[model samples]
Target: MGSLSRHWPRIAVTLIPLVFALLHATGALHLGVLQRLDDIIYDARLRATMPRTLDERIVIVDIDEKSLDEIGHWPWGRNRVAEMVDELFDRQQASVLGFDVVFAEADESSGLKRLRQLAQAELKDQPGFVERLNQMQASLDYDALLAKSLQKRPVVLGYYFTGETQAKGVLPAPVMRRSELQGRPIRFIGWSGYGANIEQLATQAPMAGFFNPVVDSDGVLRAIPLLSEYKGEYYEALSLAMYRLLVGLPEVAPGFPREKFFGSRSYGGLESVLLRHPKGTVAIPVDDKVSSLVPFRGAGGVSGGSYRYVSAADVIGRRLPPGSLKDKIILVGTTAQGLLDLRATPVGEAYPGVEAHANVISGLLDGKVLFRPDYAVGYDAVVLLLAGLTLAFTLPLLSATRAVLASAAVIAALVSLNVYLYSAEGLVLPLAAALVMCITAFALNMSYGYFVESRSKRELANLFGTYVPPELVDEMVKDPEAYSMKAANKELTVMFCDMRGFTKMSERMEPTQLQELLNAVFNRLTDIISSNRGTIDKYMGDCVMAFWGAPVDIPHHAPLAVKAAIEMAGAVRQINEEHRAKGIPEIGIGIGLNTGTMCVGDMGSENRRAYTVIGDAVNLGSRLEGLSKAYGVEIVASETTRKQAPDFAWQELDRVRVKGKEQAVAIYRPLAPAAGLERPLLDELKAWGAFLRAYRAQDWEQSDVLMLNLQRMNAKKYLYELYSERVASMRLLPFDPEWDGATNFETK
Candidate 1:
């Protein structure tokens, strides 16, 4: 049962990872951190497996530095664009031409509108008359020329949508209308405003697509919407519209899974985007939001060789080979730094925006678009559950090395399987949640084993650090398994010390000053006992209760207790000398020591417990401390302690039946170190012992003579003077025949 109890923490921490896994499985929690990490992992795998070769099916007519140098900067005149359009189809013989640019505003850079306004207001009568004006009107109207060039051509114009309230320019007919969706369950991204080509240019172009890329919170272009809805009408993306035109103008429709496939749910969103044409049905992959992951075909444009790029200036100037763009899907866009058409993608940071559309076009043509199905959540949850449970049960049963190796194998398997699904099956599945759970479970187990399971040393420190000396505690900690604080009867030494006149001293000083003085006295007295290797049980007011043995055994507790009592008496005198010099009140203390078998251990109520001793021996020690005032001595000890420490000079204080005790016990005062005392003091001690014998024997006259000699040698020795008065008073009273010279302390 004890061994089983130690494993409880390991079992509890293991359930933590399982809880997270369960929450994720139930869709009650969405770990966005894990999702983002999985996104990064998917990107790395995508980049590692991408075919880094050029696709000659699509070519970009880049308005590069060379083109800008020759063509005189951006927003070029309409006639210049018209000339490039003619150059691509008529001269270069391109199969299809798409504009990755917008013609939202009229091309007023031609100065044609200004010239007409001037002709109507100021220069109406100044030109070569109406004939010359009419002839220059046809030549200067560049918008008309550009519009005519676009008429009846396979040109796909690009535009963008905005979150603004007001729409801009003219939008073409939508591919699908809201009325067509009628009750069908499908989700489409909605927009508030759009920027399309002007009326003439839009009507003249064969088709147009909004080239806006949907950026994520982390500012990465990962997924794009093939179709978006605005004002109850649906518009196609630049890539989607271009793919449609390339595939013989397929009709756009929403594809849905069978009703049996979705079960009880009201809607399952879009399953795929259908491209219906004369040949058959071509299903383009799309998620619930009708968005597809951008299948990046390596880094494209000028830096990487994913697509061939030709300068628009060279094409317009007829400087390139005749069939340079022959039968190629030509996309007209800018690679100039000033255009700001670069984007952050999986392959590179400054990925060409035009090349992004090209990759989508190629992906749709090749049917290689990645899909994240509705069942991906279920798939991830199952993996997380299995991995978490496996690690939870396995780690605790194995050693550290084997546990780590097992965790590594689990993580490697998960990653390998996820990557295989991504590369071979074109599936986008989550991987981070399960991997993090496995690693976290393993770490929790290892940390618990290292810190909590191996805690014997900490237990020892906790038990003895507060009571015993630091050196003793250090030694006990080294062999903690051999000791415990359990109550038991053990022969030990216990001491109690209390300050005399503390109540009156406290009344004379401020509270703070009294507290500081008390702290100084106790700190000094405690150091004396601690230096002698005694365990301090507690400090109660101005008194200190301490015991030696039990918490850690000491074979010679009696001598240690006696030695500590002697030092405590000397320490009080030294303290008083320092206090008298500082004009502070001096203090004094009385200590009592005893040696006997007593019960000792951690004892108290449930609210608080203290590692201490309790029994008759401990109580007698406290009573003896109180008797020190009556005996006129600094220290009082039981005869048991006096007999054990023979190296100390002893003065028999009394034989008394203390309160709550029937037996009369002999008590004595420890005078000083026997080796250091002079012969005169020894002679005084001899005279005092003889006086005690005579007084107890009822020989009052002889006892009086002995006490008088003791007082004459030391006139300030009030104890002998006290005995002289007692002997005189006893002579007048009737003596009992049963009297044994044992005093009875009835009040305690």
Candidate 2:
């Protein structure tokens, strides 16, 4: 049986995978149940982990070909642009400015173009003399004044980085290097692009960021490259430059964890962003491109929202607010019809390309991005260990019904807990493994109970000859192992009850009438038993047998059994009252209860079986029911039951060894008095107990005293003389100390 019970748990464990697969195939379980809720939680979590705001920002002053065509031709002459910058700094007091454009060649104004021709002619016949004379002349540097103007103030220039192997254009020097992140040396590859600024002017800007948008597999710009090292030095992106200016954090903290040069975080090889401060170093979370998730407050869609397009024409014209450009870092990008600066982002397909930088700057300022690490094995191991160990202990002691219920509850609890940790605690523990364990146990146990164990229960029921309660057979089917033939000592509440003079009722009634009447009374009693979750052991002809705290360890089984008894007596009384009104014969039943340790299990032969309890308690319960008539009450219980059930209302009836025995036992009736007796009859029962106690102690004076009062109060009461006679006899020789409530049986 031990082996079988162990196997029962395995049966539940084995079949779950099959059921889960079936459910999965049908699409019954999915995250869609709470997709909206999960989104909100994840979004809020991501929002709280990014930077607060942007600083030292440079606004791109777009000198699009449109402004060029409106003024004149392609090169709008460095003189005009130089004049604009001079007015911006001197009059408007603009703190900083950056150009998204570059100049690789020297500016050739109309005057210089004419001077070169005249110089070449001066040495026309002189051969090498023409080159010598032309070189000697001081050629006009058109952008020279513009370079000086930009150099005197703070300005940052735009540059880019690439991995084209063969350089496509000019590349910038590295600012973020491998030594800063990795303990080892680093290597980088880059491309060359056209630079339009004059070399002297390019040196004027203090910092710069390569404006290269990194897109993920879905073609969304979710993250950006914060650092990309080349050879041994790392360079910063436009967003990073702005962040450093904002926070004033040292580029490198004193001691920091070094990652390998190849790949450190989820942002591919160069995705991680490490910044140093007094407290500790903080890693800005990014995807493969060292970019963070964009927080789009609205659906900016394919066409990005309008930026605060501050016109350069207005600022130079003094057509702006007084302190608008005083201390602000402005990015000047084009919104003119043809110049495109838009790209797709996670929240918007057509987000402004420059807005990606703005979003990153916002993230760094707001601190709302979440980072998932590459090394998350520790969290997974903990979850797996907890789930596996808990299931091991939980599956063994539980029956099929309880096991399945607990498994469902555990799975739901784990899911809720994990979701909370993920959202609130920033924890990313394994959810799959624990979920699998719960689903596996429930699916296996239920399928086994329904298909396998239930069939056994029906068979066990079929084998129990005249076992009475057929539902016990069904209950056994749910967990046949719970009904094993081997018995263990268990404290139980046993109830034995029988209909009074059922044989006499069979005499006058026709067979059909008897069947109908028995069915009605039996149905009422069965209702009471099941309503209180008590097991009906069987029905012996017109008698009902039941026991509690078996098959299932109900903590309050005693109370439940007592409650069922009280209810059963009331139901029978209600039926009797209806019968009396209809001029039918009244019926009555006697109920007895006892609580003690006993052995309960399957009994009888292989071909026939019985699920019943047996012990001295069982015999006593039957005796008490038989003595109920002598005590003139419907329900009687032993003192053992009355003690454990002190919360219930009870009336003591007698100390009697009924019919065929010596020794005595105290018997009491649970008087739901309105249900079992008339108001006067209850007074008579109390008066009777008063008389019986005296009789047992040989107090004839007290017994006779109570008998005289009882006869006066109610002459219709029965059993007074029975106790009076016993009192007379006990007084002659007295009872022995070895006496108990033992009744000698004349017949089996």
Candidate 3:
């Protein structure tokens, strides 16, 4: 709870971007840049995953430049169109044919209308002219010939819808009427004007569809409306019409969402268009706008190789073998540039508009059309919430490197899920908002941590950097509010180390040389103390003081302090070796460790304050350091420190009363780690223990015998020799029953 409270400001900063993302997702605020980025992402994904292989089921009979050159300009004579239609169905045996062009006016290229005017007025006086014209009428009437050729054929005529209010030509029967919806308002793409086939061709070919595609705000054609509204009647697109005709003309009905996930009145748009047949029902998914994303197979045009492009002149000229295109669905469209049929698509700019229809028809046949579900907005909101909150809460707690890695992982997951849905499930969900939200949240979090929260850490580092180790200072800065320099008593382990021979060395050596040697020695010793997690208190003349379990609570401070003292003794021995090689004076150090309650914090006069410790335990530790030289040992520790640190072996020094204290305390010299003690040392300590017992009991004869054995074990040992002298002197004194087994010292 404290950690959360400390980092709440950072969490709030990270959530700033999430609010904007949610607004953009829910339509409260629209971000045009995000939408444009989404379009670019969709385009790149489509191009990368498109099946760039040939589709043999459908073929495009392109009226190319070659055909236009061979047959003259566009809007060729209707007799020629009739001939082409006859060749496609009768000669080539194609199963279905769809025209991507509209015939809005009657064909007058054959001069039939001019001849009729002449026969009615100017040429009325001519006798054989009228009779000859009547006989040639059947062949000259190209519109009638073309209409007759289209009769009873499996042909789907294409038309276009416009936003203008002008309507022209005739429209085929709508696939669905508004009454069929039962008055439920469905928001369909509505158009006010249309250009359809002529009445003559409409009557011959009753099946027709509009070829209008749904253009995005960026002017890219990515989807086509399967059903649009005109005068309260719903019409189908060219692709949908062709697909229905292929499927035996199933009944079209609106498919509503099965689960009202957003409530009844939330959405009234059709979820899909159901093709109801006796066998079963085939549902084609649509977006809220009743549009499906065009599943482009590959690039368009002759060299694209997605669909076989046959020149119209080849079919009309009978240059190929008959029945070569037998049972193949053919789309009659012009690919000539002058015909103006190009459109900008996701896969390519200047894409042939006719090929767009062909791609849609191909997708419809394979049931692989992609769509944005009506719940896509809800999905976006949920994903943004999850990712945003995850980053907002987690990034503040993690380090900079970890935060970056976490954010990258989140983005990769979102992209992977989105791509899987697009490729495997044919779902086009919104991804831009979620992606932007994650990135922005991470950036905001990192910025806040670096700029705002770093101030507190810097202040903490400045306050504690000198007295504590860098690592401890780093740890304290994570929660700087929990620590302060106010004086407090704590159960701490205090250490006092004093140097020997400093006065003699300073008297003989130059002042600069003595200062350099002192600094070098202190530097090496202080490193060992800091490495062992000790906080340096202060440095007195020829002495250094330190303690543990302060500013940061450490449960094992006694063991750490004891270990540091041991290492510091070893460091002095090494320094003596260097002094011997340099022909300089050698030095010695004595360290004392005691564990007890002590006051530790910044304490001094108002002018100059120092973070130090002061209490009875601290004084006892200093007194123990002075006793190290008397006991002929490098390190001395109180009974309390030895009890707290059981990992090391100790040789009992003495129980003595110091100058300031009346109570006697037992002190021991740390030998080595208990596990590393040698057999010889162990036997010697056993013998020494027996000698102390006998000497304290006034057993003079037994003490002398044990002393001889201890002398033989280590003859040059100062401690055992000193005990032997004491035993010899005390032998003459009478034994006092009131005497306690402790030594007393009255001097400072």
Candidate 4:
């Protein structure tokens, strides 16, 4: 509760960005940043996943520089173009021919009108000149010759529409009329002007399509309009027209999503274009703009090699093999750099504009067109709502490691699903919005946790900086609401260490020197305890109290306490050496450790609370610290501690009742880690065990003999000497069989 109360502002801050992103995705708000990001990601994905293989069905008849050098530069005379068309249809056997070039104006390059004027005016009296002009007139009319070649042929001429005011030349027969869609409220892109074929060619080849390419705001040609409106009539793109021609020129109609009968509503937005044939129907996908994404085959130009390119010069000269373009849809386009027909696309920066139309045509034929319908906005919104809110609320509750894993899992799943849809279903769904939302939500949440929530935690660390180990403080702050100062009973390992000769040593030193000495000693001892993961409870004069398994839980608190006790005893040796060199009396410390259930937490008046432990187990720890003198050892621990940490070598001290507890707890002095104990130490332990066993069995004679041998083995060992004297005194007294061999302590 405390942590939550303090850090709720950070949690709320993390959610604010998510809400704004949701609003933007759902169209309620217009922050345009996410949309731009989505556009870039979509472009990259499209480029990366393009099928780089060639499509053999469609071929490009390119008027490249090589062709230009061989057959003269572009805006070629109508007579030569007439020959090229005848060569492709007559010699190469192309099934269908479409021009990417526009022939809007009349072809007067042959200058046939000037000769006729001379025959009529200046050479009127010349009989041969007038007759020759009259005879050669039809042969000199190149436009008439080209029109004658286009007559009754499967040649689709290309033209262009503009946004300007006036419509120029003539347009082909309308594929769809405005009267058909009059009452449906269909929104079509309206164009004002157009550049169409000359009247002769338009009348001869009535089948034509506008070759106007729709470039995006970024100047990239990603989509081509399948249908556009001009002067109350609808015309098809070159790709759509060519596709219709290939499929037997089916009737094209506007398609909408299947919906239940609702009176007089716009059929939402254009979903697809339906082609109705006698045999069956084929639905070509398109977006609301009536545009379809250009499925790029590869990078650019000849390197893409999506379609076979044939030189116009070769075809015009009939230098190619027979049936080389047999039954193939041939599109006549220029790849000359000066033609300015190159366009920018997702796949390439300078992509040929004609190839962009070719890609769309091929995609429509194969049913591999990528569709991004109006409903994609709704899909993006749903993903943001589900994924964004999930991360926003849940990430703050997780640890740093867990939060990272969670974010990674979400991102991986989202990307995998998106890529799968792209590969399998041909759906160009909006991936950028969902992806950006997830990333931003996670980033914002993590930053808030670090900059905002962590500030409170750092403050908590400073508050308890000197009282506990830094690691403990860190763990406690992870869930500060659950950690309270209220008293609670927990199984903990507590330690109490008191300087044995500190009072006598301090009496001889001045107050200033004694203070310095005490500070140095406490500093060294406290470091040992903290380094071993124990929390210091308090310090009184020369005595220091510490514990483990509170503020943070250590499953093996007993072992940690025992390890700290050993290290502290070793530190005293170093302390004493320094003191002896400084001409001051050296002191020793006795440490006692007991592992059991005890009450631990902050306990005191409201103004002076201290985080400490209190219970019978704690009292026993203090009593054991005092008994270290009686055992002639520096450290003593209850049997419970020895049992929990069996990896350490322990020597039995005695079974005695302490000042507070009634149960006669057995105590032992921990020596060293059991792995490093010498064989002599093991043998001595065995002998001591035997002596204690006999002493408990009332075999005084056997016990006396064992004790004497143990005394000889360690003649200066006071613990053994004390036991020997006790055994002798016990022999003089009457023994009771009911005795449990427990010595009772009568004083504190």
Best by lDDT: 3
Q: Residue 185 lDDT in model 4? A: 59
Q: How well is each residue in 85-171 modelled by candidate 2, as lDDT tens digits?
A: 776677657765554444445667636666567666764676675576456443344567677667756555556555544332234
- For each candidate in the order shown, give its overall lDDT on alpha carbons: 0.84, 0.60, 0.89, 0.84
Rank the models by TM-score, top first: 3, 1, 4, 2
Q: What's model 4's overall lDDT?
A: 0.84
TM-score: which is higher, 1 or 4? Answer: 1
For model 4, what is the alpha-carbon lDDT of residue 487? Answer: 86
Model 1 ranges off by over 4 Å: 1-12, 25-27, 182-185, 258-267, 452-748
Model 1 per-residue lDDT tens digits across residues 42-114: 7898898889888899999998989989888887888899998998888888888888999888887767777
TM-score of each: 0.59, 0.42, 0.60, 0.59
Ranking by lDDT: 3, 1, 4, 2
Please give, for residues 333-393, the per-residue lDDT of candidate 3 as tens digits.
Answer: 8889899888889887888888888999999898888898887887788888888988888
Tens digit per residue, CA lDDT, model 4, 1-748:
5655565665676567667876886679987777677678788988788878889988888898998999888888889889988887887888889999988778777778888788779988986998888788888899899999998889899999898886667788889876766356556777989888889888988888888777876677888888999878889999989899888999988777664332213347767788999999898878877888888888868667688888788888888898888888899998889999988888888788888888988898888989775566666666667777677667777887898899888888878887887789887877766776777777777776343268768877766666788877877776667666678999999999998777886778788988888898899999999988888999999999999888788999999999999999999998889878977788988998999999987789878988899998898899999899888899999998999998899899889987766878899999899886999889899999998899887788999899888877888999888888888888887878888888888777
Model 1 TM: 0.59
Q: lDDT of model 2 at residue 636?
A: 85
TM-score-wise, the better of 2 and 3 is 3
* Cα shift from native, residue 321, model 1 (Å): 1.1
Clashes in model 4: which pairs? none
